[model samples]
Target: MVGEDIDFTRLAVILCKPDAVERNLVDGVLERIAAAGVSVSARTDVVAEPWQVHVAYRDTLTDPGRAPADRPAYLEAAFVGRPVVVALAHGGPDIHARLRRLIGHTDPAQAVTGTIRGDLGSDSIAAATAERRLVRNLVHTSDDPAAARRDLATWFGAGRPAPVCDFENISVVLCKPDAVERGLADDVLERIAAAGATVTNRQQVTVQQWQINVHYWDLLVDADWFPGRDIPACLEAEYAGRQVVVALAHGAPGIHSRLRDLLGHFDPPHAAPGTIRGDLGTDSLTAASAEKRLVRNLVHTSDDPDSARRDFGTWYGARRSGLLAPLLPAQIAPADA
Candidate 1:
């Protein structure tokens, strides 16, 4: 259950439409949602099943006065081929309105200038109708509180509470091979605990090439990050066969930045004294380059909440039911206050 004082916190559902998925606009859409102060709770990439679409749009489909006979089929067709990202977002006060405003009007042309539909959407209702197709709006949000609850139940199941938003902040941290091999994992975890973050989950695994490749895909493309080298080969050499400690940490908001600060810079030599990298790591980028290897940075912390969720999903599947279940209110309450 949600905290009593914050009972007003609302939940909304967002569906990244198939066109957006095909265009690879999931990250940009998520960034806009986060910028609106909504925190993503749970997310999954799924191909919309016909039954699900009918269930989701039942009212619209059944209202003969509103929808044309072919509307349901057209809608289903639009959603079937590509994977749509269905996400639950939570926020304090008027969350439904905030998400609706962010998503904009049903028609791109009539939508306000600053909204997501206005900015990213290209198709108009008129154009779509003329072509006998569904409107290519980039995303969808529930119309009201009732609709939000209904859609959430339909999409994410009836009783499951959204995960990440249950905590003030959730972050994923990795004690990379260097730290694990050097037996510095405990020291790094101690520093995190000392900073007031709780370790909700911990697991040690020898990373796979595919997982590492997906995890660091963005970094692989950045020339500065992997200068003058084959990024995949380098990553394989450093991480693929090595064991790393992947930890999920929870704490107050801004925990990601806090942990990153504790972990210090990527290059140990450039890290400030007293930080984990500064204290435990000694390898330099220059030395690594000379040796044709990666700098032995001791730890990795997510850059922000979005990055944290994405990394967590990549490392651990999105449906994190038992993996690091959050503490119940009774468990955290003082015994004899």
Candidate 2:
């Protein structure tokens, strides 16, 4: 029942199958979901354990007490050893139904064109049956609202105890256009996870001039922050028209600083090796200045709590409430009180 508080919104789960991930279709699948007006509230890449897969498809994996005995085993095998992206998507009251339709039928050949499976998938049940394998559909969505709730909990621990945070910090990390264009979004996300944070909300969007202005208002106007740097020119030269992957990550105290460290220095040449920018970025401030462009650092992170809150507001208004609201501490005492 964790996700059943409909009240004009519903929660759904989408699993980008291993084949989809291998084919690098995660971004396309997410884009389609967002095109349908669904927002991703939480996401994680999982190399699922057998038990997790069993829990995810409990009905199918159970002894059917009928024919087609090999179906369940084939399905289970398909899920094992492959990395899948598990995402929690929220939308209007009919979100569950919408996602099912968006993802398409279980058998790729039977799915209608334009749906994810029909567009990206090439395998069929008939061919799979002939090959004695499970249909290699590109994605999976909950069959119903009930299943959505169950799968969310199963994958994201909805009802489980919250992880303790020293300051209950939340920060925003943006994978800049260059990173996405280079197919480094997954690598960046993996590094974020490696740094001990959880991505609670994510969206892929083209950067707007106004949002960039607001995001860098201080650096643009306040010489104290940039020490005589020209704000407007910097903004126009770098972020004016670019695609960016925005994500909200939560962790213990100092999460903002932790993310900043992981992102490396603003200047790629000066960034220490092993950090995101140092590892992936090649542009230098001198070179960029000569070209009248901004350094091609691969990411952006909030510098502090205030900036985190501000950036979250600018990128995701009410949608932020879905993940942030539940994390707030309760004020009421227990009945024993």
Query: Model 2, which residues run further than 4 Å from truth?
Result: 1-8, 14-87, 92-94, 106-109, 113-140, 143-167, 181-183, 223-230, 291-293, 323-337
lDDT at position 73, candidate 2: 78
Expressed as tens digits, the lDDT of each residue in 42-142 for candidate 1 is 45777777777887888889898989978877877887555788876656558778888888998998998899989888889999889999889899877
Clashes of 1: 0
**True-structure RMSD for candidate 1:** 15.7
Clash pairs (backbone) in predicted model 1: none
- Pairs that clash in candidate 2: none
- Per-residue lDDT, model 1, residue 86, is 80
